[model samples]
Target: MASTEAIAAAFRIDPQILEKWLEGKQPVLAKYASAHQQIFAQFEYIGGEWHPKLDRQSSVAMLDEPSQSQNAVESDRVQHPNSSEVDLEPQSTAMFQAVGIVTGAVHLDWETHKHSAIINGSTYPLFYISQKRKAFEALKAEVAATGNSRQRLIVYPRVIHFPNKQRAHEIAFQLVGFDKGQQTKQEVSRELLDFEFKLAGLWQFIPVCRIPCISIFRNFSSERLDYIKQAEPAKKVKFLKASHLPLLWKDAPCKPFRFNPKAEGDQGHPTFVTLKVKFLPERNVFSFVEQLTPVQETAPPFLKASKKDKASLRRQ
Candidate 1:
């Protein structure tokens, strides 16, 4: 869900990185002179503030107390649940996982070219191509069905890192939940990646801290696309792409199946997965499909292409 704007603000990289990305010049970030610390962690709302919660074993998890004041949950400082352990070294792209209560209503935003959700008083983006309308309708249905229960939306994003400015530095020092003491802070220069960074031109502030900002996939699946409900194999897969691969081709980029917030199992949590961006500079276009390597089959490969080539052809 990282929009072009968020990427610019959070990182000290090229302002036109997105444009260059679309133009087929794969943007490579400046490498750190030394190894930088990166954390893959999750957080939860507890005791009127966001707390780091890595354990997923709890069946009856309480993210918010019934009597908790709305102001606390709606605070902009603690809007995100996850934290990072990044340093001042030149930042690179990384992914983080987060869960938040979906606030406000779901609606399409043409400006950002994404469906929008207000999570904890902050705006988050959802990207769905082709069947966007269907996905939007399904999300609306789930939100309405959940009513006042306040369902949680989980997202996985590959975000770019930027140097922490004055505000970000203060927020980093203000955070209170790290398990380790000051020594840990010294070793890993922990900072809040969600803090504001400078954005110019078409780049705007993107609230989601994860993907180039946050987006949906695995946890936020769509029941509308669950046509083969009883089919064990299909159901086991977390996410599904929308197109098919060609013979001798692999790793093609395709849109994911529509999301269904009301799907069974852990009804309170909806999730989404963002695919890694890829490009073909030679072709001057995004590379949706990749050519496969040669196989060592003695006989002619008759059933080869038909085998898994239909990855995108499956009925959603």
Candidate 2:
């Protein structure tokens, strides 16, 4: 059989919707199609001051690969810039508190833009990936250079979900902060989707400061991701083979399954990775302080005396 992507591309259908159809779960594919359309539109071209793109691996070819096992990698314990990119405005004071690596197999999820930043004699603002899917086929097999050998060893694959209408609405309200009915909503929705997709492209490849316990689940399919979301009310899960949803709180992180690029035939399916998750501090957004001062009574003495007399009279 043709790969799911190939088949979907041939028919001009979203690959995610096609995955469910292949699985014989065909009732509500329309909802997913709606979301996929809105989200995919913004990914075409993210013109920005700084963008993340793939740079060649910095490591000079060694006769033998580094003898770094999983344990050694952990013991070395490098903190990645540990990214979950947010286009922060002049918000409050915040610093990406716990800076380190996001463990498990990482995927460069979005396109990267380059700006001139140099650190330790190396270029700053390097390449990475993030939020949503890019063009149909190009995103899946793209290479991410994380100078870290640990991240390099893992598989990379296409793992993303379209922004649901609710997500779009939230982005519209929070980022755009205006609601002129449907038109503005749609515009903001596109903006949010584009922002995320652009972030995914950059962050996925760019290194971070914190080492998070996030593992990419191999061999998972979009259909399976939907099914996993259908847990009972107690679990508050409702995704699984239904549709793709964002990974909300890293604190209460959801282990959505994803395919590993290098994993063989069955590796494209999804499964949960058991990570020892530890909450990290907020990303630093500059610093802050506050000041207060006493105010003298500006009221006339007659008024003050009248108020006092009124209080005394009431007491009597």
Q: Give the top-scoring candidate (TM-score).
A: 1
Tens digit of lDDT per residue, candidate 2, span 244-311? 11222333222323324455554321222221122111321111111111211111111001222223
- In order, what lDDT does every prediction score? 0.25, 0.23
Error of 2 at 227 (Å): 9.3
TM-score of each: 0.20, 0.18
Global Cα lDDT for candidate 2: 0.23
lDDT of 1 by residue, 27-98 (tens): 444461111111112322222222224242221122111113322111111111121211121222322222
10 residues in a row with least lDDT, candidate 2: 167-176
Top lDDT: which candidate number? 1
